[model samples]
Target: MEIISNEALSRCIRDAVRAELQEHFKTGGSTGNVSRERLLSKQELAAELGVSLVTLTEWMKKGLPFFRLHKRVYFRMSEVLETMQQKI
Candidate 1:
Protein backbone atom coordinates (compact mmCIF):
# COMPACT_ATOMS: atom_id res chain seq x y z
CA MET A 1 0.00 0.00 0.00
CA GLU A 2 1.27 3.44 -0.94
CA ILE A 3 1.01 6.27 1.56
CA ILE A 4 -0.29 9.55 0.19
CA SER A 5 0.91 12.89 1.50
CA ASN A 6 -1.58 15.43 2.80
CA GLU A 7 -0.89 17.87 -0.04
CA ALA A 8 -1.34 15.16 -2.65
CA LEU A 9 -4.60 14.00 -1.05
CA SER A 10 -5.91 17.53 -0.86
CA ARG A 11 -5.04 18.20 -4.48
CA CYS A 12 -6.81 15.02 -5.56
CA ILE A 13 -9.95 15.97 -3.62
CA ARG A 14 -9.93 19.48 -5.05
CA ASP A 15 -9.51 18.21 -8.58
CA ALA A 16 -12.34 15.75 -8.14
CA VAL A 17 -14.67 18.42 -6.81
CA ARG A 18 -13.75 20.79 -9.62
CA ALA A 19 -14.48 18.14 -12.22
CA GLU A 20 -17.84 17.31 -10.63
CA LEU A 21 -18.82 20.98 -10.50
CA GLN A 22 -17.77 21.48 -14.09
CA GLU A 23 -19.95 18.59 -15.13
CA HIS A 24 -22.82 19.82 -13.00
CA PHE A 25 -22.66 23.28 -14.52
CA LYS A 26 -22.22 21.93 -18.01
CA THR A 27 -25.49 20.09 -17.52
CA GLY A 28 -27.16 23.13 -16.05
CA GLY A 29 -26.85 21.96 -12.44
CA SER A 30 -28.45 18.63 -13.22
CA THR A 31 -27.27 15.06 -13.36
CA GLY A 32 -29.09 13.87 -16.51
CA ASN A 33 -30.99 15.35 -19.44
CA VAL A 34 -33.62 17.13 -17.39
CA SER A 35 -34.86 20.67 -17.15
CA ARG A 36 -32.42 23.13 -15.67
CA GLU A 37 -33.05 23.56 -11.97
CA ARG A 38 -30.52 25.45 -9.95
CA LEU A 39 -29.98 24.37 -6.38
CA LEU A 40 -30.24 27.14 -3.81
CA SER A 41 -29.01 27.25 -0.27
CA LYS A 42 -31.38 28.11 2.55
CA GLN A 43 -30.18 31.70 2.63
CA GLU A 44 -30.41 32.17 -1.11
CA LEU A 45 -33.89 30.69 -1.32
CA ALA A 46 -35.14 32.86 1.54
CA ALA A 47 -33.73 35.96 -0.11
CA GLU A 48 -35.06 35.06 -3.52
CA LEU A 49 -38.52 34.39 -2.14
CA GLY A 50 -38.43 37.62 -0.13
CA VAL A 51 -39.09 35.69 3.05
CA SER A 52 -37.33 35.50 6.37
CA LEU A 53 -35.32 32.52 7.52
CA VAL A 54 -37.91 31.72 10.13
CA THR A 55 -40.61 31.63 7.47
CA LEU A 56 -38.49 29.36 5.34
CA THR A 57 -38.01 27.08 8.33
CA GLU A 58 -41.74 27.00 8.81
CA TRP A 59 -42.22 26.11 5.18
CA MET A 60 -39.78 23.27 5.58
CA LYS A 61 -41.75 22.02 8.55
CA LYS A 62 -44.88 22.15 6.40
CA GLY A 63 -43.31 19.78 3.85
CA LEU A 64 -41.62 22.11 1.44
CA PRO A 65 -39.29 19.97 -0.59
CA PHE A 66 -35.62 20.07 0.30
CA PHE A 67 -32.60 17.85 0.52
CA ARG A 68 -29.60 17.65 2.82
CA LEU A 69 -26.01 17.12 1.93
CA HIS A 70 -23.11 17.21 4.35
CA LYS A 71 -25.46 18.56 7.00
CA ARG A 72 -26.34 21.46 4.69
CA VAL A 73 -29.85 22.04 3.32
CA TYR A 74 -30.59 22.69 -0.34
CA PHE A 75 -33.73 23.48 -2.30
CA ARG A 76 -34.38 23.26 -5.99
CA MET A 77 -36.08 26.36 -7.31
CA SER A 78 -38.41 24.45 -9.61
CA GLU A 79 -39.60 22.19 -6.83
CA VAL A 80 -40.06 25.07 -4.45
CA LEU A 81 -42.10 27.00 -6.98
CA GLU A 82 -44.26 24.00 -7.71
CA THR A 83 -44.81 23.35 -4.05
CA MET A 84 -45.78 26.94 -3.47
CA GLN A 85 -48.21 26.92 -6.36
CA GLN A 86 -49.84 23.83 -4.98
CA LYS A 87 -50.12 25.38 -1.58
CA ILE A 88 -51.77 28.47 -3.01
Candidate 2:
Protein backbone atom coordinates (compact mmCIF):
# COMPACT_ATOMS: atom_id res chain seq x y z
CA MET A 1 0.00 0.00 0.00
CA GLU A 2 1.23 3.53 -0.89
CA ILE A 3 -0.12 7.00 -0.10
CA ILE A 4 0.68 10.38 -1.70
CA SER A 5 0.50 13.53 0.42
CA ASN A 6 -1.37 16.57 -0.97
CA GLU A 7 1.44 19.04 -0.10
CA ALA A 8 4.14 16.95 -1.80
CA LEU A 9 2.04 16.51 -4.93
CA SER A 10 1.28 20.25 -5.10
CA ARG A 11 4.99 21.17 -4.74
CA CYS A 12 6.04 18.75 -7.46
CA ILE A 13 3.36 20.03 -9.84
CA ARG A 14 4.27 23.66 -9.14
CA ASP A 15 7.96 23.03 -9.86
CA ALA A 16 7.17 21.16 -13.09
CA VAL A 17 4.88 23.97 -14.33
CA ARG A 18 7.53 26.58 -13.55
CA ALA A 19 10.18 24.65 -15.51
CA GLU A 20 7.87 24.32 -18.52
CA LEU A 21 7.02 28.04 -18.46
CA GLN A 22 10.71 28.92 -18.36
CA GLU A 23 11.36 26.84 -21.45
CA HIS A 24 8.42 28.39 -23.28
CA PHE A 25 9.48 31.95 -22.51
CA LYS A 26 13.14 31.26 -23.34
CA THR A 27 12.37 30.88 -27.05
CA GLY A 28 10.30 34.08 -27.30
CA GLY A 29 12.37 36.42 -25.16
CA SER A 30 15.41 38.44 -26.17
CA THR A 31 18.82 36.71 -26.40
CA GLY A 32 20.71 39.64 -27.89
CA ASN A 33 23.19 42.22 -26.59
CA VAL A 34 21.53 44.91 -24.48
CA SER A 35 24.04 47.58 -23.49
CA ARG A 36 25.94 50.15 -25.51
CA GLU A 37 29.65 50.85 -25.08
CA ARG A 38 30.05 54.48 -24.11
CA LEU A 39 32.91 56.79 -24.91
CA LEU A 40 34.49 58.55 -21.93
CA SER A 41 34.13 62.32 -21.66
CA LYS A 42 36.15 64.72 -19.50
CA GLN A 43 33.90 64.15 -16.51
CA GLU A 44 33.84 60.38 -16.90
CA LEU A 45 37.56 60.25 -17.54
CA ALA A 46 38.21 62.19 -14.34
CA ALA A 47 35.94 59.88 -12.32
CA GLU A 48 37.57 56.76 -13.73
CA LEU A 49 41.05 58.00 -12.86
CA GLY A 50 40.01 59.35 -9.45
CA VAL A 51 40.82 62.90 -10.53
CA SER A 52 38.68 66.02 -10.63
CA LEU A 53 37.62 68.06 -13.65
CA VAL A 54 39.59 70.94 -12.19
CA THR A 55 42.72 68.76 -12.24
CA LEU A 56 42.04 67.88 -15.88
CA THR A 57 41.69 71.53 -16.70
CA GLU A 58 45.01 72.18 -14.99
CA TRP A 59 46.64 69.41 -17.04
CA MET A 60 45.35 71.03 -20.20
CA LYS A 61 46.62 74.39 -18.98
CA LYS A 62 50.04 72.83 -18.46
CA GLY A 63 49.82 71.13 -21.91
CA LEU A 64 50.20 67.61 -20.61
CA PRO A 65 48.49 64.56 -22.26
CA PHE A 66 45.57 66.02 -24.21
CA PHE A 67 44.02 65.29 -27.58
CA ARG A 68 42.78 68.05 -29.89
CA LEU A 69 40.91 66.90 -32.96
CA HIS A 70 39.36 69.47 -35.36
CA LYS A 71 39.32 72.15 -32.63
CA ARG A 72 37.65 69.81 -30.13
CA VAL A 73 39.21 68.18 -27.08
CA TYR A 74 39.43 64.42 -26.51
CA PHE A 75 41.38 62.06 -24.27
CA ARG A 76 42.70 58.62 -25.11
CA MET A 77 41.37 55.72 -23.07
CA SER A 78 44.78 54.05 -22.98
CA GLU A 79 46.31 57.21 -21.60
CA VAL A 80 43.68 57.38 -18.89
CA LEU A 81 44.32 53.76 -17.91
CA GLU A 82 48.04 54.45 -17.76
CA THR A 83 47.49 57.54 -15.63
CA MET A 84 45.30 55.56 -13.26
CA GLN A 85 47.90 52.83 -12.91
CA GLN A 86 50.78 55.22 -12.44
CA LYS A 87 51.64 56.73 -9.05
CA ILE A 88 51.00 60.46 -8.61
Find the candidate with the highest lDDT and give its number: 1
Estimated TM-score for each candidate:
0.61, 0.38
Write candidate 1's Cα lDDT for 1-88 as tens digits: 7699889999999999999999888976766667556789999999999999999999999999998999999999989999999999
List the pairs of residues colliding in candidate 1.
none
- lDDT score for residue 10 of model 2: 94
Judge candidate 2 against the unseen true structure and give its global Cα lDDT, from 0 to 1: 0.70
Best model per TM-score: 1
Candidate 2: segments with Cα more than 4 A from true spot: 1-39, 81-88
Query: What are the lDDT scores of the predictions, listed in order?
Result: 0.93, 0.70
Residue pairs in collision within model 2: none
- How big is the positional error of residue 11 in model 1, measured in Å on the Cα after superposition? 21
| Full-model lDDT, candidate 1 | 0.93
- Displacement of residue 22 (Cα, Å) in model 2 is 43
Model 2: per-residue Cα lDDT over 10-66, one tens digit each: 999999999988986986544565323344677777787788989988876855456
Task: Give Cα distance to truth, residue 2, candidate 2, Å.
Answer: 99
